[model samples]
Target: MKFLLTSGGVTNPSIRSALDGLLDKPVDQCTALCIPTGMYGHPWVGPGVKAWEFVAGKEEGNPMVGLGWRSMGLLELTALPSLPAEGWQPAVRDADVLLFSGGDAVYLSHWVRESGFADLLPELTDTVWLGMSAGSMVTTPRIGQEFVGWQPPGGGDDSTLGLVDFSIFPHLDHPALPTNTLAAAETWATGLGGPAYAIDDDTAIVVTDGGVEVVSEGTWKALAM
Candidate 1:
């Protein structure tokens, strides 16, 4: 699967172009599935208005689901375990992209595995996994202790899906999030003990065929693992 991981959603032209490249066609011609399961696990953004805004394309700073597509639908991971694969797997296979909302990466990772979505990763060879904030973080090897929230049921470590080799620090140097500064990201990287990227709202990391590319219109820094 291809990845268009962003600190924020496609908030700029450059990142939008990168997404278009991943799609290999117009955004209007593609189908998308907005996964808001991650939102419920976050303390700051739990299941309610936030989740509704994301699916309804009302998220203030994050511009994901609002993007006009041929069709858009929801794939709540928490509910997947109760249903049969034949009931939903076909929709996943047919979709052109999966839009993951920002929230708790650890929580999202847990449900991804629990709902059997982890097993479907290999089959989504042509699908794009577009992520924002925690959505993007969940794809990495670990999110570090700094971003840990909504811990797993068995009390696991900060480790995530590890779909990507590096970790991510989202919302770097934002006005409201003082702790998300470059200095903080550096400290977080030190604790991670691995390669990582600290990206601002305008930046995104595109991964395809094992190649890593940064698409940015703002600021970012790469910390050595």
Candidate 2:
């Protein structure tokens, strides 16, 4: 699968162009499946109006589902286990992209495993995994304890899917999130024991065919492990 991982969802023209390249078609021609499961794991974002806004593509800071796609659908991970894989797997295979929203990576990763979605990823070769914030973070090896919030059932480590080789510290230098400064990201990276990136809202990390590239129109840094 190809990846267009971002701190913010297609927040700038550069990132949007990257998305277009990944899709190999216009945004209006591709189909998308929006996964809003991660928002529920976040205390401040889900099971309420925030969740509704995200699904409706009206969330103030996030610009994902609202993008013009041929068709847009929701894939709530929590409901997948109750249904048969045959019922849902086809939809996943048919979609051009999977849009993941920002929230708690740990919770999102848990459901990604529990819901059997992680198992499906290996087969979706042509699909793009478009991730925002925690959505992007979940693709890495670990999110670090600083980003941990909603713990998994019976507990687990800070580890994620490790789809990529490194870690990500998102939302760097945002005025509203003072703790998300570059210095904090650097401090967070030291304990990760692997390569990591600290990226602002205008940045994205693209991974296609095992090649990684940073697509940014804003500040970013690759912290050494």
Candidate 3:
């Protein structure tokens, strides 16, 4: 799948051009899924956003991680798209393209697995998968370890969606947000012996059948397996 694994939003012109270039489709038909960065702040973990919210609220961020294609779809004003209680058996089954927004890595991962989207991902080979922050983390083998600071419960499981073999370390050594924490996630990745992709807030990791290419306004380092 093609990916625009951005650190955050593509606010830069050069970045936008680069993003546009990533698409195999024309710009007008380019659709995406937004996952909200705000969902991380919720008290409970995965059952996901309240269904009423989708009908009554408006999330102001990315798509893949937030809702499915509904944002770029028919919905006018909507809330964060949680896993369909009825099941993602149909919707996620045929997504053409997905865009995950920045948010809590743990929450997104939990929802993906709980919602059963993770299992169906392999079916959507025709779809392009793009993730922002937390969205990006979940694409990797294990997001809870490298992105989320909290550990697995005493006996409960914390398995990931396992898209990529690498782990992502976000908001580290960046100049933007002062509230983000690096130590917890950083220390975790260091011990895993897995490759870590360290990205500043301005950078991005572009993936294709060719390879995972680092592209952005600054520097990016990849710790390989």
- Candidates in order, TM-scores: namely 0.98, 0.98, 0.68
lDDT of 1 by residue, 139-161 (tens): 99999987887877679889999
Compose the digit string of candidate 2's lDDT tens values, residues 163-217. Answer: 9999999999988899898889999999999999999999999999969999999
lDDT of each: 0.93, 0.92, 0.55
Name the candidate, 2 or 3, with the larger TM-score value.
2
Clashes in candidate 3: how many? 13
Candidate 3 ranges with C-alpha deviation above 4 Å:
37-71, 74-90, 144-146, 149-159, 176-188
Q: Flag the better candidate by lDDT, 1 or 3.
A: 1
TM-score of structure candidate 3: 0.68
Query: Residue pairs in steric clash, candidate 2?
Result: none
User: In candidate 3, residue 199 scores what lDDT?
Assistant: 71
Predicted structure 1, TM vs. truth: 0.98
TM-score (C-alpha, index-matched) for candidate 2? 0.98
RMSD (Å) per prediction: 0.9, 1.0, 5.8
Tell me the lDDT of model 1 at 123: 94
